[model samples]
Target: MTRLTATAENQSLCTLSRDGSACSTAKYHEGAIAALAQARRALTAAEPGADPDDPIRAVRARWVGQAGAGTTGAAWRAYLEGGRDGLDILLAPAGTSTGPAAGTPPSATGPTAAGERAPGPASRVLVGSAAAGRLGGGRWPRRRVTATAVLTPALFAVLVAAGGGFPAAAPWTVLVALVAVAAAATLATYLPGPGKGRRPALGCSPCAAMAAMTVLAAAWFLQAAPHQPSMAAAALAAVGFGLLQRLTQTDASCAS
Candidate 1:
């Protein structure tokens, strides 16, 4: 079920465009909508009149109706221009007893007429809302940046020693230790955490630059440290961390 929802969301995101013209992307919206409708039906069948206000139904109806009415998707478009606040507006209408109202908190009603607990605003899921700004504009994770900085240099040093470029010496050991210390310092001082300093979210350009620098580092470790499983594991972990930096919003915005 989780897998199916992801597919539908991806389909909708792929079909979305600046204008609602009949482009290649627009063509896929029908499939996405159908998928959502199917899921909503299944859920409805499971509950069996538990509630008429299913969130999935609202999402499907709004997306399809908005498209047919030739209204540009203002809610989601606002999400692109604005972030989470826009998302709140986009999702506000779905499944509400009263009409759609931006930023209105969901009702605190304990149960529906059917005697089942009602789903709240938080339970609603809007397609394309989850991974917004991730394609090219999102900020990279700070922890990954720190790991790449430390390990890449260490990997290069290890490779040079293995290749007999120079005999492994105390000086090389000290250099690697120094690099680790620098990385730790950077992580502690600059990166955002529960109570750390606040910084505006940066775009992906810096991430790309850092990735290029560390790309060689991963290669070096793979080649020279095959016997040491831990080094290989760290290198792979760095790659995974780099890929997982998608953010829905910055900490500062979330904080405010």
Candidate 2:
């Protein structure tokens, strides 16, 4: 994908988070460099058909020209210092262009100066458009993450109740193992993100596998009286089952 397209995708993902700053540094840097390359190439290309007066194109061309061949410095200044949102603005399709370089006032005879500024409702329209695009693309993984987070804690609570209560004297080794399992599950949830496609109907194999793994691990390691499962055992199993679901769902969505 073009850097602009990839950067747009990355920014779409960032919207899922509250802080509005979730994409990794590596991805941001990569996108910025690629975007600069795009601008540079467009500027250098010998094309008779390309418009010379397109403001967005002009701004990008100028920025890339000023940056020259030093992509590292350009990437840092154009993206990191100004913020990834600025890149998002730049990536905004040509006519909707706004970005770090967009701060320069529009020319006196340009669209903005001709009393064509969009009203407040136009901003809402853009937001809705963005939301629809994300949904149609199946790029949002919020459902998977939310479900796992909620279910994991609930499963633990249920298991604890069924087991009567956690023994105050549980071994440190068992606690360590439980923590490790939880960490593993959490890690699994986020590694492979969702892809573009319709979400398939929920399947059972992953859920079954997660449940089995959790139960077996608990059964093998946790010492319990008679037939009753230990609270710690239940907690360990729940963590594995709950967290792993996110990873499984992500894989399944991608497969579909």
The lDDT leader among the candidates is: 2
Per-residue lDDT of candidate 1, residues 167-187 (tens digit)? 445554444444343333323
Residue 20 alpha-carbon offset, candidate 2, angstroms: 26
The superposed Cα distance between candidate 1 and the true structure at residue 82, in angstroms, equals 1.8
- Name model 1 segments beyond 4 Å from true: 1-81, 90-123, 126-204, 245-256
1-256 per-residue lDDT for model 2 (tens digits): 2332343453332333322232332234333443433333343452644442243355455554544455454223434323333223434544563332342212111112222222232242343334333322235367545644655555444334344445534463345345344634453344334553453433324442453365435533434542243545454656556445543343321111
Error of 2 at 233 (Å): 21
Error of 2 at 28 (Å): 6.2
Question: What TM-score does model 1 achieve against the real structure?
Answer: 0.28
Error of 2 at 108 (Å): 26
**Model 2 segments more than 4 A misplaced:** 1-72, 81-188, 196-256
